[model samples]
Target: AVMDFACPGLMGDLTSFRKIYAAPIGKAGERGASEEEKRIGAARRAELGRLTQGFIHARKADEINASLLPPKTEYVVFIRLTPTQEDMYIRALKQKSLQSMLGRCGKSDAEAPTSVLGVIQNLQKLCNAASLVEASDEFDIDASSKL
Candidate 1:
């Protein structure tokens, strides 16, 4: 029926189109739709399958493999955090637990993120470089776990 106004008889007259396709599909979209409603939806969907069948084919495995790009370079370097940094991370984790228990674990409009996820993110920043959170005047890359 919507097609009558939307595309003017493109799918046929609104009444017939609604009875054949739109109504069945619309009923299927609802939560807890009846078995009969679902069956009708499947039948209607099957009827329209050919219109998109060609576009639904999968890509070949060979094509997928051929499309992959090789990595340019890779290296691994490890650095240990200072004791103070580890202590700060532990304190943040404990604070995050308390905040979660109080139903105050998500970011607020005026605050830096303080949720459990946010606190974990802060810990990650600390691992990368303490300067990210502490705003140190002199950043020491050699001190970061990621460097």
Candidate 2:
């Protein structure tokens, strides 16, 4: 069985997985792949897929042991952000770097900067506690809205 904490798609035929593995190793990394190289790589990948058909069998958790698992339920809860959290969140959203990243949304060819996830995490931290995102020693614990 294959498992991943963050990316379960690693077990499937995902384009992101292909992109990660197709990147050249050592000095000739991802940046070295030219348009022609990419085309050839795509052709080779297609041939490999054709040759490896039916070689893998994937099973889901439910399929393995349905009796041991319970039915799934999702819950959504809403809470108002504290004034401090709202202020910090708004400031984070207004930052030029974040604004530029957000502006790229909905573009088919736009590549998301790796830092986007970090920026989002920081924003989430800010909502959880001002101390998490702020470096100041004078940060108040009461600034956390979730508490």
Candidate 2: the clashing residue pairs are: none
Q: What TM-score number comes out for model 1?
A: 0.40
Q: TM-score, each model?
A: 0.40, 0.46
Off by over 4 Å in 1: 1-10, 13-19, 54-88, 96-147
**lDDT tens per residue, model 2, 57-86:** 657877976777777789988877778778
Would you list the C-alpha lDDT of every candidate in the order shown?
0.68, 0.65
Error of 1 at 1 (Å): 16
Q: What is the lDDT of candidate 2?
A: 0.65
Candidate achieving the largest TM-score: 2
Model 1 lDDT on a 0 to 1 scale: 0.68
- Top-lDDT candidate index: 1
